[model samples]
Target: MSKHIVPLEYETGLAELRGDCARMAPHWVVPAKAAASPVAASLIHGVTVPPASARLIDAMSDYGD
Candidate 1:
């Protein structure tokens, strides 16, 4: 016969408290000047891949397929 192990029970409301704290924590906001700049904006929003890099990525994606 196999014995089943029971998981431990955490204190009630702990998860809710943690989530509340996380929601209340301060977050960084990008400056308007930086956001207005093209390069800075691209970096802040996401990485901008060059055409060559994109082609390389595409090639890699097809690898081992």
Candidate 2:
């Protein structure tokens, strides 16, 4: 006989989460602000924030007391 594995709600949730993670593999494309000076680019578009980092930042903000 053959056995199979099934996903419970938690597993399904994790799978969906993984899918979301995969979809957002690319970091946010923050373009350099045209109106601002060259220095602004260093502050704004310097760091590329991947989706995972965005989620973590949101979670941290929520949990911060």
Clashing pairs in 1: none
Off by over 4 Å in 2: 1-43, 62-65
How far does residue 16 in candidate 2 sit from its true spot (Å)?
56
User: What is the clash tally of candidate 1?
Assistant: 0
**TM-score of candidate 1 versus the correct structure, residues matched by position:** 0.24
> Native-vs-model 2 lDDT?
0.73
- Per-residue alpha-carbon lDDT of candidate 1 for residues 1-65, written as tens digits (9 for 90 to 100): 99999999877598898887788776646557745534554457555779997777778857524
Work out the TM-score per prediction. Answer: 0.24, 0.25
lDDT of 2 at 32: 88
**What lDDT would each prediction earn against the true structure?**
0.72, 0.73
Reference-based lDDT, residue 55, model 2: 78
